[model samples]
Target: MEPDSYHRIYVERTLALIKPDAIHRSEEIEDVILKAGFAVLQNRKLQLSPEQCSDFYADQYGKYFFPNLTAFMSSGPIIALTLARSNAIAHWKSLMGPVNSTKARETHPECLRAKYGTTDLKNALHGSESFDAAEREIKFMFPNSVIEPLPSREETEEYLSKHVNPTLVRGLTELCKHKPLNPCVWLAHWLMKNCPNMPQIVVEEAEDKK
Candidate 1:
């Protein structure tokens, strides 16, 4: 699809990570995501090195908790997923509940973290807080999968020809009309099926509106 055509569709993207603690609890985590309506753009299991962990959390480098956070992140393998949907960041964060496990346990006991997280740093999952963050995180975590340099008109046309079938495109357009707050899984599936080459920014813009 053309960039302008994609803008007409209302798309959005976010990044989500199922931390080491959730390795044995993949089924449950996946259930929460499926129910929430996000599409998985790409997913991988990665065991981060201490250096990688530090770089990934660079913003928190000098925090009092930095050392512990880095160690915990490197403790085991983690699953990273590029999620697409309407209101992806907000929806993913809501599903994750709160940053503080104690609060998550008390106020949102049904959340993913409340069910699986051991501490604030060992939280079973992580999500991008905004579109910009999502883009950066996705690039950092999946550099090979990252599609840089916007697709050209010919590339877009070829992508549309190969992937964006009428039935799939119509279904996503209908989904956009539903106006749900989260709707990530639904959007993810749609993108997987029809708009695989759609830019992350285009997807985010599509879902930006309430």
Candidate 2:
């Protein structure tokens, strides 16, 4: 089915990574993204440093799986992409199927990960969970191009007024004031509230601003 015209007008973007394990299956992954209506804005392959891997997975630092995850990520080269489309995050993740290759194959045989991945950690792909994460992850991976000016105060206020609830607006405003990180979660929540029936991909993209 075709995407809604309104959604097309408000197209969003997200970051997607094809891990080393999927290098041989890159074409298959690209096909999946294209079929999902996402346009590849930028793409590249790089061998990551251990420091970069650790920084990228910092959120999982305290978790038991962090060490292994870091090792796996730094083990080989990876493909990074900037994908543009409506509802990018959720859609991309859906196309990726599950984190565990075994489960993905059984439950979503046609999914990218299911077809190319060898295991859970080597699951051939990585997608930012939210727009904020996408922005951070993308910047961490592609420092040069990812750096851009933050939204101005007036712009932020206007955006909040038009798209967010008063209660949420206040919280998000505070978040911007202190954290000043990407506002992926706040943006996703806003889109969900305003466009409740939008596709998952659209929601994901909305969250992945960078």
Candidate 1 per-residue lDDT, tens place, 56-137, comes to 9998889999999899889999999888776678888999999877779999998888988978888899999866787889
- Candidate 1: lDDT of 10? 44
Best by lDDT: 1
lDDT of the candidates, in the order given: 0.80, 0.77
Q: Lowest lDDT 10-mer window, candidate 2?
A: 1-10
lDDT of 2 at 118: 84
Error of 1 at 120 (Å): 1.3
Summarize candidate 2's per-residue lDDT along 115-186 as a digit string, tens digits: 889898889999989878877877777777845534543565565456544645566666677663567776
Error of 1 at 153 (Å): 20
How many residue pairs clash (N, CA or C atoms closer than 3 angstroms) in each of the candidate models, in the order given?
12, 12
Deviating ranges (above 4 Å) for candidate 1? 1-9, 148-210
